[model samples]
Target: MPSFYSKKDLFFQLFENQNCLELTQLPYFSDHSKETFTLVLEAAEQIAEKSLYPIFREMDRQEPQLVDGKIRIHPAMGTIIRKFGEDGWINAIFPYEEGGQQLPWVIHLAAGFIFQASNYSASVFPFLTTGAANLIRTFGSKELKEKFTPKMFAGKWQGTMALTEPDAGSSLSDLTTTATPASISGVYRIKGQKIYISAGDHDACENIIHLMLARIEGAPSGTKGISLFVVPKIRLDGAPNDVLTQGIYHKMGYKGAPIAHLMMGSQEECEGYLVGEAHQGLKYMFQMMNEARLGVGMNAVAIATAAFQASLAYAKERPQGRKISEKDLSKPQVPIIEHSDVKRMLLFQKSVTEGALALLIYCGILSDKIAQETSAAKKLKMEALLDLLTPIAKSYPSEMGVKSTSMAVQVLGGAGYTTDFPVEQYFRESRIHPIHEGTTGIHGLDLLGRKVWLQEGLGWKTLQQEIQHSLDQVKSIQELNDLGHSFEEIFLKFNHSAGELLFKRNLGPEKFLADATLFLEASGILCVGWMWIKQAISAQKAISSGALEQSFYLGKIETARYFMEYELVKILGLIPRFHAASYPTVTMEKDWF
Candidate 1:
């Protein structure tokens, strides 16, 4: 199999084709160029291959354990994390004043994909830390930033977003964790139990900073009352904060990272500094949640990418049954890659994984655009469009990622099911992507229930205009015109189906969103179709210019065509059901099963 580094050109080309470098014109990213991005990717690729990938299976087999009331992870985790921090990867996207390179988020995430594809479980520690540091940097006070942000960015300390509780799950309103006024100004005494906290407690770092959510005394119930807190495992005075690690939850895969159950302030001594305001914790968390959602999707894409490459390599070397045309037993068996069914499976994985990477990287580009955009109206429009696409960005790559990995496994047959190969591990790891950040069902509801109709449905309308823009850009390209027209037709049907559902809003929640998951599925297909169309056009431009990597560009175009023909067409059959808005699931009684 080709090393993940071997595909650097494909990723960089996609990044450049998407105009990611435009962010350099922004004051924050002024120092960066295409060459700078290459330098960053090269550094990351070296770390991934040399340090992370070597221990991928070892870390999983050893797994993190709560030994003697302290979490102990694989020994190599400490070295990899130190390298990540010292290399400036933890702070790559932050401002230079904060000891960062001020690189564009697009490049940051592109490097992120390489690291993640190499070893997701081990790679998660830095990713989660970056997210936590960003949350505090964006919303924390000067004091909070001054004290903790620098250490985190320097990778001296680790950070985590701790939101899930034993009883609350995804419902923040039901949270019972409480915060009270502390002796120190802006600080509070916090008491709560958090569950399923990733990188919660590990021996790899000197300190663990948790961006936890809790309800303050006398605050209103539900999401409105939740408040954000900066809870550290060790206090500034060097005494342990009242944070206790109950245990590590054994997972099905990605076993290298530890997920902990934490009891905060069991001894009533946990000190937490409030972030932003008293009752806006949920809002702050959502900012982190949105970023995490994209990370989840990226992780999915990376896993499937690895699986595809592995399977493709295996298919080329593993000789199977003779070709159908060869009737004699004496004939030598050909490689399975010669089989049409195997080719189909490989193409399925390629289309889904590559298309997913494009969509996610495009999301990163949009994020940079929002930061550089000074126009208030345009920024608002972009924000709206991002809101509408977030669920799809999170859901499609994830849900389809599972299917793509399954296809990878299928290509490997029985070997894919056993521990002898990594495909089984990839399949196991991909399962959690759809369930993390937000489950597919949660995102489905968010898409249909809130985002679609926000700003008098302007979010949805703005997306339509963008899709039309892609269609216009490809109309003159001879080879893509038919695919373009097919996309336009499917989008029309999509709009009409959505229109019918919008018309039934007054029919109550059940009737309004009975088929919301299907709607999400259809919408995900449409979004990926748009991304593939954009990729194909980019490839055509490259081919017209006599680019050196002709085969790579051609492969992109072919994959886009395959996705349109086999995957995008599924929406046609789904539109009728989307329009139906049938309440069958809602109407079915609990006892029906």
Candidate 2:
């Protein structure tokens, strides 16, 4: 019961330093203020600690079960859902007219981190529901929104995105699900099996709304012909829809939320309403997918944050051998935290988790700016920035969260490996994130294959320009000059490396993308390096102003420095890997493996 997550001071200071409240000037958030943001965060924290945190272990211990084809989750989850729904955290970013708080995306994300850090499994249903509902609100017809959005937003119903199938996995082009036109104007009969669906079914709500993907019969093959649909578990006429729970998947982590295999139209009665025009399901779903990717990044950070705190606390109290310089035979043992190696491990976790959090929070702020900006050009530029950052934002944190939590385990030695501490659970849960939104492989392809080159490389260029602006701000700070210059070289190297890939495009797409994952890994490291530098600048400003929380500000600066000196240098190893003309992966024969 030692505090797993109690970092309100650091969290709030990040919000203030990031200028999250500046979004209030926009009409969408005009009614809100700093006070409103704090109120919502407190409400979320109250629910997280009072309701969710207390039962996190129990929920994990007793994973959801499939009883007579009905999935039964932890009983405690129902209360958490109700409390969040009532408090509007379930729909915090929805428009006010739609019964939401109309809070800025950054603040909403901050609140989400609180709950996720406290108990991600309990918090996941609402997160899935919010993303599903947002897709409907953005693209669904009036009838669809009116019937579904309110119920979902009110927490009377749950929502899920149904995209993955038995064979498709991440390849939407291969999905075999089919839809046929129904007599109703917008309705279609859905017939497909979606696997690994989170919150796919549960008894905590009156209904489960599935934002599903399928192909119309005889539609063109691959992703182009696919379409999106609103498939409900229960039909409007009060009978069960043809959606059947084939089985509930037991996972190593995130055990509280059921991962289900679902069969739609098994009884040939599954009715689905299309969200938009045909052959646009992938396009529409990509929006939700991107949102989910962002969520994945945040979830990874939250879990790692908890692991770091637990390990840090234990390190401070656990007595071990004397320091390297000490004659240990004659003296009492010092805390493990005083040991250089233990501190190094903890610092690695701290740097990665904190830097990842700052990067994702910055993405959230850009998300709000994109929503509120009036100028079409500015909006387009903001969109490009988001496009470029999304892959790194999703992959870096996820991939590193696994590494960070593993270090947390190393910090505690034996206890970290056992259920006596939650670090092991954190480690298990963090592994799924890289595979969840899109595998690191897929994201790397997206980054190097498409996002970086899309719109004539506008996204890549815009991101570099912004990073340069941050470095510019630190020029007059003599102490940061050398680090700022080092980051500049890092940026130039990334830009040049990307240019090399673009130049090699004529060699064949296969060769061009041969080391795409390595490219992504390199980019992720550099992007996070940029974030740490920005945080350092923010901390420096606070320190100069003689902030009351001097220790907090000092900690931020030191963490930033640690990341730059230790983690950021990783990009050097990948640079040569990026330059290889013939990747061994593509050269190996199929029989070799």
Q: lDDT tens digits, residues 8-51, model 1? A: 43454445458777777888788888788878887888888888
lDDT per prediction? 0.87, 0.85
Model 1 clash pairs? none
Report how far off residue 270 is in candidate 2 (Å).
1.3
Query: Best-fitting candidate, measured by lDDT?
Result: 1
**Candidate 2: where is the Cα deviation over 4 Å?**
6-13
